[model samples]
Target chain A: MFAATMAAVLVTMILALGRAVLGPTTYDRILGVNMAGTKTVLLIAVLGFLTGRPDFLDLALIYVFLNFIGTLAVLKFIEHGDLARNAGDGE
Target chain B: MLEMTDLVDLALLLFLAVLAITIAKQRNLFVVVIVMGFYSLVSAALFTVLDAVDVAFTEAAVGAGISTVIMLATLLMVGTEEKTPSQPRILPLLAVVVTGAFLVFGTLDMPHYGDPQAPIHQHVAPRYIEVSGDEIGVPNIVTSVLASYRGYDTLGETVVIFTAGVAVLMLMGQALRFRQRDGDA
Candidate 1:
């Protein structure tokens, strides 16, 4: 069951990677990479279960927080050229 | 007998691959981003079927939530079209395909699914299942490996996050302060 699922995850990651590679725009590539990161987190988690190691849960949790913060920071930088933008910048 | 989980996992994987191909072939950028989000969600579901709840949660959050937002924000900055190039780079595409093929082939050596005698099942896993109650007392073996035997790796992973944060700050932190100073001037 786990093997089948892993294969599926891999297939998705490959597809996302293709998007990341052949993206028409930078944002499209970023989106693909972000989705890839998300898939990676799940891949790690599923692999953990398949391997029967629950300790991987900690890594997965930490990864989730990091992925979120990292994406936010990157987006902020791209949108406004700075992570710490002035309140008025959003408008 | 085909279990429902098996069918769902297979279907989702095929769907994700098709979506990816569609995104690659399409000229539209916005549609690619949206499809990518869907791809991530499906992948997350597949992870859960593998019994990796933690991974599924992270996938849904980062793939669907954070990544989509970043892509949109980036789109706002850089318009949604590619700069005209003299020629397409076929080499990069070929390289990626070859590498992916090799990886898939390598996984063939892995133990068959759910086999009780698989090395993974016979080795450290059984110990954890048996001794976790008396030793670390954690019910989840995944947690035990991450927090205990492989603690150093976890710390390294944490450091990686810290570094990424600092790097982002370094890139944007200075720019923000400079903008403020310019405004004051």
Candidate 2:
């Protein structure tokens, strides 16, 4: 059942990639990337079960943190073209 | 149970192939990166099927998570679209296809999936599993391996993260310098 679900997720990822490539805007690509990230988190959990290794989950947790921070940084850089932009601007 | 696992593994293999092909054909860099993340996710699933949870976690985090953000950051610095007008070079892609096919063929001699008697179950894994419960006391074998047997590798991973953080800081500093120079002009 998990494998089947994972296959479905793979199909969804392919569609997301297509949308990203065809997307007319930056936001669309970002959205696609975000979807991929969400799917990956689920993938990690399932993998831990399949492999009989729960330790992988810890790494997955850290990965989640990294993903969130990385995505925010990317978005900020996109808007301001630099991470150093004054935070006070609220733009 | 046997039939079910086999069916699922086959399906995953097919999906992985399709995703890889789609990713390669996609013209937009952002789309390519997104598809690559999907590929990583699928590969992680495969790793799970193969009973390598530690690798799967790393794949999920680094391959899918960090890579996507890095790709997007790079896209912002450059342009999102592929360099205009040039069709994708087919020869290199063909080479990739051939290499991948060879790899699959090379696996023909390997044990069938989920064979309990396979070398994987016989070798180092058993000791790790046995001692893990008494020595390390971590029910999660994957964690034991990462923190105990492979602590050095984990330290290396931490260093990589530190390097990435420093790189980001440097990038921000350069951007500040550029802005200041423009203002003075």
Give the interface RMSD values of the models in order.
8.8, 4.0
Docking class of 1: incorrect
Report the error of model 2 at residue A15, Å.
6.7
True contacts kept of 2: 0.35
lDDT per model, in order?
Answer: 0.70, 0.71
The residue pairs in collision within model 2 are A55-B143
| Candidate of highest TM-score | 1
Model 2 over residues B1-185: C-alpha lDDT tens digits? 56544655775687677777766677777567666765776677677666676687788777876787677768878887877757778898899889999999999978877788889889889899778888888898888998988999999999999999999999999999999999999
> lDDT, candidate 1, residue B72?
65
Candidate 2 is scored at a TM of 0.63
- TM-score between candidate 2 chain A and the true chain A: 0.78
**Which residue pairs show backbone clashes in model 1?**
A53-B141, A53-B142, A54-B141, A54-B142, A54-B143, A55-B141, A55-B142, A55-B143, A55-B144, A56-B142
TM-score of chain A of each: 0.87, 0.78
State the TM-score of candidate 2 restricted to chain B.
0.70
DockQ of predicted model 2:
0.30
